[model samples]
Target: MTPGLINGHLHVSQHLLRGFVPLAVSDTSAYLFKWVFPYYETLTSREEGVAATLAGCDLLTKGVTMVADGGTVRHPGVVADALATTGIRAHLGGWSWDHASAPPGLSMDTTEALDRLSGAMDEVAGRHPRIAPLATTIGLGMSSDALLEGAKSLADRHGTFLDFHHSFDAGEVESHRSSFGDDVTPVEHLERLGILSDNVRLVHQIVSTAAELDAIQRTGASVVRCTGTRAARDLAELRGRGIPVGVGTDTVNVSNTSDVLRALHVFAAEIREPDSDIPSSGLSADDLFDMCTVGGARTLGVASFAGSLEPGKSADLVMFDALRPEWIPMIDPVNQLVLSADGGSVESVWIEGELVVDRGRVIGVDELALCQEAEEAAAGVLMRMGARARIGRRSLC
Candidate 1:
């Protein structure tokens, strides 16, 4: 058994839109502005609550006891209360953005953005041990330099970490170059703004460079790899350099599942570089396991309690059934876990010594009811969005 896994970065609010992003959203920009942000602009409190609960249920059955929200969740109190019903720990990043890319309804000026973020953080503080507010702007691509600095200041004032998506794809990197500077990479631009620090966290940091790696190393920032194999190679380098690394399955809209085991499958098998003889990550299954557990806890700033089963730590553990066919020769537990297992094998899950999941089902949550509610919620929310009429136009189907 191991400590319950931590999904280092995710958008719980995006769960309603899972499997709905059109096939034509070929890049991060489109994924955000076209699909993601439009949904965010129109999401309702009821939808947010249901989505967070469903997201918590998905993570709990998959052996995740805690998660870090990727921001853009417009309703933290609603989402937090819903997640609390499932006994999951969370750090929420309420949305903050002041950029032209944002829909007018969702946009805010720098001062307005900072005020809203600060209010959200304060609004959730001391309310629950497991639920928290993370100072977050969606990313540099949607936030101006002034908003970035202001968000960092909120994190500092609140004595918590700041997080955002950064350098996710080629288009995003180019946008940074045009907005920040042509000469410096996006990471350098953040460094130039004094935004990189030990307390700062980043997600979707796919673009890598020697200087970027150097900056991340020097600033003591943490990175959570949220998507595909491109970041897999850099993850090995990040870990080798003693930089903390964590794993996430991204949004179901993008990856279709929040299962870390699925993320592991992508990491271990597809981590090797194409058209190259040498393996990109040279990491063993055991290393990968650590990244999922303790390393992830550390990256999310919860290692003091939630990451491991050590003495004085929080009681969070996942037990896999050994009688399954895949475990016939379970000589190596880690290998069995990494290679042959999925959420189906998870027999039970506990958080704070309380039984939360048993027989691969989440207690106190009705899968059928929640799913139906989500279906209704998604339909209602999307139906009101002006972007709804523009949807089927993009899908190849």
Candidate 2:
């Protein structure tokens, strides 16, 4: 038996909120402010719960036993209830975004936002033991660097974890470089702020420099590489440096299935630098498999309980269908899993000795209905904000 897949990063509510906004997938930031953040502002607690319920169901059925869900959860209790109902393990955060420069109608007072986050953490942490509390960062524009540092200290004292996006886009990279100058990158700024430690978990970290990588390694921080959303060379470099690199699908915006195995394959193949006098492949099949399970568990700081299939560990596992006819002889499960199999091959999923999915179907659920709700919710948000026309007008204007 093999251990179930550990998702190093996930955005449960963001799954439904994705295409309704224009962030990186668009050509301009106007759509983001005029449409995206306002749309998020309109998302009620109940809507987040629904999204979490549906997304959690999808993950478990795909053989993912655990996920580190990062976001500004307005109601942590509601999120925990959703996770418990779905029967999945999650590290849920009470998110905070207290930046004055943040888009209007979406910004919260810094102190008030922290108060809400703290209340949510207290309410949810005691009620849901499987759901760990984390301090998460939100907002696209520059906020008080001091707030980020303070949140890290708070999370550490609570014996919880910290998660944030780092250097995800070229524009963000440039913004950091221009603001901070040659003295440091945003990550270096984070390091100075005292958040660079084993408890810190970063999503993306795509455009960071080699020196910054060394700093993260020195501090024992972990990085969750969304291979489905990044260039391959970035993953390879991080892997070579002994950084705890795990695999994630990012969002349905980037990948429809959110399958780590497929993400690994896409990255492994994409990062190839044109074989040069090299006798061995840049990435091995086993390496990719380890990234999905062992690496992911380590990145999330849950290796002791979740990484591998061993006695005394929780019974979390996934069974894939037999090798395809093309792979007539099952040479290596690792190879087949990384290079050949998709979500279709997943036959069953077990989490904490409970069966959540069997025979390639989510137990006691209607996927079509879920899809309809997600689509309708997304369309409603877009329509309310006039996002389609707004995007076009912004381009024309």
lDDT of 2 at 42: 72
30: Cα error in model 1, Å: 1.5
How much lDDT does each candidate structure score? 0.81, 0.71
**Would you list the clashing residue pairs of candidate 2?**
none
In model 1, the clashing pairs are none
lDDT by residue for model 1 over 1-397, one digit each (tens)? 8789888888888888888777556677667777777787788888899999999998999888888887745787888888899988888867888876567778777788888888889877777888877898877767888888988988888778898887777777887788665678888999999999987887878777889999999999988887563656576788888888888877998768888877877776666447643356568888888777998888867789877789999889999888899888779888878877876788899999999998988899988788878777777777876535334322111
lDDT of 2 at 34: 58
Candidate 2 TM-score over all chains jointly: 0.86
lDDT of 2 by residue, 319-360 (tens): 877755634478876777778775557788888888888887
